[model samples]
Target: MIEVENLTLRFGGLVAVNDLSLVVRPRTIHALIGPNGAGKSTTFNCISRLYRPTSGRIRVLGRDVSGLRPQDLAPLGVARTFQNLELFGGLSVLENVLIGAHVHCGGGLRERLAARPPAVIGHVEHLLERVGLAEFRHAQASALDFGRQKMLELARALAIRPRILLLDEPAAGLRNREIGALDRLLNELVERDGLTVLLVEHVMQLVMAISHRVTVMNFGARIAEGTPAEVRRDPLVVEAYLGQEAAHA
Candidate 1:
């Protein structure tokens, strides 16, 4: 559903992503993994149009994404969550998720200010329930614990009704139980809802358990791309992580 061809991103003398290429198939979970500074996040930014590539091409569902703004991608069925939480702390959970529905809203500011349609209000309630935050719909975003806050973020992203989801380290800093819940949520997203996922994560346990394919990078270049088992046994992949011991530290 997403393709990056010979992608390169450079900042003056610094090359963050160097001719990296990968394809994420529809209805599948594809993982991009590497030690720090390996350019996983850079590649994600390119796909999300937060950063334009210095060279090469990115295609989403066969349409080239060049020149498209980040907001443009959302209407085309793309949604993403940041590695860090990006919720509005002062807003109620329901209000924060309603912000994501702006792409689907047809009315102008005046209409919105007048009131939300019943359908829109119901949709937000459903989303809160789906993310296990039904009772917290009126709770302040900052009042929720960290794990619930993350789920709130996920609910907001789902409010976009995306065909493809890009997640950057969704498992980071979560408790084991929270990660397990996330894993199940992801499985349902793909297996039941048919959402394609492209994830950049350091949690090998989550990546290997959930991803159908894994791509490993080192120094801004792809070193291995294959099934989780294949990547786990790859000599170069092993070397890349072990050589940096910093990966685990």
Candidate 2:
């Protein structure tokens, strides 16, 4: 559903991403994995329009998204969560997720803030239940533990009702139990809800277990792209993670 072609991003003399290209198919989980400074996040930023690419193009469902603004992505059925939590500390969990519903709401900010229609409230409540945060709807967002807070962010992103979701390191700081739950949740999102996911995660077990396809990057370019097993056995991918001896072994 998303295609990036020969994308390059340069910061003066340094290149953050060099002619990187990849594809995310519909109704599947696709992973972008690399070591630090490998440009996985930079590629995401470019697709999300947070960074303007120095060269090449990005297409979402055949529409050129290279020039589309961040706000414009929502209406095109794109939603994402950051590597770091981006939630309103003072707001209730319900209130925070409700903000995502604004993407579908009509009228000025005042009108939206005045009184939410019953449907919006119901939708937010349902999302809370789905994300296992039903009881915490009225709780202060900052009061939740780290794992729950991450789930809250996911709920808020889903509130956008997106067709494609981009998740940046959604498993970074979670406990093993929480990570397993996350794995199941992501599976349901694709298998049951028909959502497409493009994730950048360092957790290899989670990435290999859940992703239908994986792209490995190094030095700002794609080093390998294939199914999890294929990538795992690739000499270059092995070399990138291990040393030369491991690759040749």
Candidate 3:
């Protein structure tokens, strides 16, 4: 559903992404894995139109989006969650999700909340339940535990009803149980809802267990691309990111 070709982004002398190219097929989960400074997030920024690339093209849903503004992406069915939590601390979980829904719901925040349109309300409630935060919907975002907060962010992203979801490290700060829950939720999204996902995550088990394809990167460029099993056994991927122990595991 997304294609990036010969993409490069330079910050003066620092080349954050260099000639990177990859494809995310429709209705599947793709993982982008690499070391800390491997430019995964930088590539995401370019795809999301948060950063303009120095060269090359980005196509989403078959249209070249290289010149579109960030706001332009949502209308084109794109949504994402950040590596760090971006929830509004003071807003209730419901309110935060409502903000995301505003793109589709079309009303002032107070109007939407007070009227609680059946279509919008039902969608938001379903997302809350999907993320296991239905009970916390009325609570302040800051009041939830970290794992719940992550789930809340996921709900907000889904509020847009995006065709393609770009998740930046969704498994970064969670207990094993929480990670397991996330794994199941992601699979369900792709299988049941037909949502295409491109996630950048460091959790090897999560990536290997769910991803249809894996692309390995280092120093801002792709070093390997294949299925999860194929990537795990690549010698360069083992040395550069996964390590020998992880490769063996």
Top-scoring candidate (lDDT)? 3
- Which candidate wins on TM-score? 3
lDDT digits (tens) for residues 5-107 of candidate 2: 9999999999999998888999999999988889999888998999999999899978999778998999989999999899988988988888878786766
| Candidate 2 Cα lDDT to native | 0.90
Local distance difference test, each candidate: 0.89, 0.90, 0.93
Give, for candidate 3, the lowest lDDT window spanning 10 residues.
107-116
Model 2, residue 72: what's the lDDT?
92
Worst 10 residues of 2 by lDDT: 240-249
7-122: candidate 1 lDDT, tens digit per residue: 99999999999999999999999999989999999899999999989999999988999989998998899999998899989888988888777776656534442456678788
Sorting all predicted structures by TM-score, with the top scorer first, yields 3, 2, 1
- Alpha carbon lDDT at 102, candidate 2: 77
